[model samples]
Target: MRFRIAAALLTTAAIGLAGCSTGAQASDPNGPLRVAVSPQPHGEILEFVDEELAERAGLDLEIETFSDYNRPNEALTQGELEANYYQHQPFLDEYRTEKGGEFAWVQPVHLEPLAVYSKEHRSLQDLPQGAKVTLSNDPANRLRGLKLLADNGVLRLKPEVSESARVEEAVAENPKNLELSTLSPDQLPRTVEEADAAIVNGNYALKANLKNPVAIESAEGSPYVNGLVTTPQLKDDPRVVKLAELLRSPEVAEFIRQNYTKETVVPAA
Candidate 1:
């Protein structure tokens, strides 16, 4: 859900701002821009921008962290935040399509590969028949997990199954007869010790210190690069533009390379 990061930890402004702003012009144009983010790479990346780059660039930022995937966009839509950074275009598309809103994806900042992690097994081949496998509960991520399994030859999806296919319609073959289950994305890492395998998002994997994975989604030609998203009016805001530039800057890219492995967090090309 939506929660404030302690001011000391985030180095941000106080979280209790008045609500009711409808768009970019609704809030003080010169005030610190409130941007919502996930705690791992998203928040960390913005923290770099806030502490290192913002002042010099003449931008002020207030960072809000969220645990639930739905909260950032919800807050943004309600004007509690000016913008957000934590989702790919596909996830954003699904959210907009289902929930009905007008939001713009600014630009891709990094790619966090979906991965298969397990504490009970060393490799996918080691998973025994009827092994418990858990995937994140969201539709886009669930389909993504299914694709990751299919890529590894553990399961076979239907020939005609598209990207939007549901979990049931996509699974055409299950050679291991694996017992698949769904859990919240945040819960996947905690289940690693109990389940035979879990297909986890790269951000959550890193947060839980699950750096090494048996298999990971390839970043090359991937459309799932997480980026900045804002309302239509805020898309052209000077502060938003400056922040986007900083997010894709050489320094930010270097920070990503030095701090995160290519497997976990890859700077967008």
Candidate 2:
């Protein structure tokens, strides 16, 4: 009878363990979803989402902030991260083409307009001839800078030059004859003192504490907006869908508006 009681006790303990295991599985189907992001406002933005919504959705969002553009994608592709929120579609396409990786943009999250910042000039019109202008040297960003320049009449591109056109494609008719220099996006903010003007990405500009960039890209209907991206396998996953929805939530939208005012970091509808 004591052996039978011992067996019953063992069975009860096994059932309790199974019940706890089942409860944990129900709470976190796949456990926490790890995300990689660029430092500052992007990372900060994620903090808001992670605290306010992700936790409630059973998503344990672990954010690893990167200082440069290259590592986030590398991390995501290597399966070290489940998703990333630091690049535009054009940039992602170029990265995939060059790196031979398999990843896809899950959804458009925000538009961080590329802007021209200067200590000497209040507007692009104030930029004089021979002004030293710094533009991002990466293929994708070079094109974006060129388009912004074209929009401001600083340079002209062929009529057919679409959003994808790069500096080499410019047909410079009456080009401000401005001296253009190329640098990494991260270097643009530091070089602004020497440069009469610099076309800097929104995040870098914000990092350097430069307020109200002289000229911002008009991203009203532009496709060059930034997005949330993930591995191809996770594209259809319900967790990804939920995360995307949270990104577009009212709370995230308000955070973006308050944090990136005049920088135009619009949340995706």
Q: Which prediction has the highest TM-score against the true structure?
A: 1
TM-score of each: 0.89, 0.83
Tens-digit lDDT track of model 2 for 1-269? 00111324433443454335422111233656667677656777878888777867766666666665876786666565678888888888888878877887887877777889888889988888878888998878887788788888877777766444555566456456788888989899988899999998877888888776889988778777777898878777777788888887888888888877657466654
Residues 68-136, candidate 1, lDDT per residue (tens digit)?
Answer: 677678777777778999999989998988888789889899999999988878888888999999998
Question: In model 1, what lDDT does residue 248 have?
Answer: 96
Off by over 4 Å in 1: 1-25, 160-164
lDDT (C-alpha) at residue 81 in model 1: 76
Can you list the residue pairs that collide in candidate 2? none
Model 2 scores worst on lDDT over the 10 consecutive residues at 1-10
lDDT of 2 at 124: 86
**Candidate 2 deviant stretches above 4 angstroms:** 1-29, 161-169
